[model samples]
Target: MVPILDYLLQRQISPQWRGLLTALAEEFETQIGQGELRQLMYRVGCRFAAAAPLPPCSSTADLADALNACWQETEWGYVELSDEPEYLRIAHSCAPLLGFGAAALSWTPAFLEGVYQTWLSALGAEGLSVVQASEFDEHATIEFRLGRHPV
Candidate 1:
């Protein structure tokens, strides 16, 4: 998704066309209920993990390093992780979600949350849960807490 959007941006595509595409995507997603969308995202995440299981992250530092490496590989965003005693905090500069209209912005977070939830599940981090608390412009802030699983 980010790759395609970035490609369009790199080619200097018209903003109107981008907006139109974004709008259409948002509309399409709306037709799918939250439960179904999340199920699909979970499956996608599982598939991603099955494709290539990277080195296991056994500690917060390792998790941070792994996430940053994944972000670099994907070019989806810049990710920063803080391993606090109470929670794992993540701040992301999601480049693809930038410059789009507000309507398009709403769905990306939920999709991302689903992805994170499933990815973590696939990684066998059953005790950790992803909570998307805030989004401002292109930046998104999420928190992960131990012992609280996402249902």
Candidate 2:
């Protein structure tokens, strides 16, 4: 997700990328579904960011400019934010740069030993920061810090 969106931003900047994206997407949809497509997309995206998972930029302007060309290309097209799916919430929440970057639902303690560990591990490896808070007396609000970021 975060990785894929990052890739999408990067891809959008290039001239020949739309066709490349179309080809990649069609291949995925034909060979996979949303789940698998997401996994594959993230895998491909991580490669591009491998050189520097995080870079020290002097100001927000630098980051904005750095992202503008790419963002305008991929995200320049209209997006229907009002219509979103379940996974949309998860992707948006856990992705690196979104405003709401994480939400943890309360489950049996056993669940944490499984899903949480795996997810947190991957997120940490990717340099996302985590924040947690108890939710609705049952669930918890666990998220990654998206704005100020983490070193």
All candidates: TM-score: 0.63, 0.32
For candidate 1, which ten residues in a row score worst on lDDT?
138-147
> What's the lDDT for residue 32 in model 1?
81
* Model 1: residue 20 alpha-carbon error in angstroms: 6.7
Query: Which parts of model 1 are misplaced by more than 4 Å?
Result: 1-20, 29-52, 99-101, 138-151
Query: What TM-score does candidate 1 get on C-alpha atoms?
Result: 0.63
State which candidate has the highest TM-score: 1
**Residue 58 of model 1, lDDT score:** 83
lDDT scores in order: 0.57, 0.32
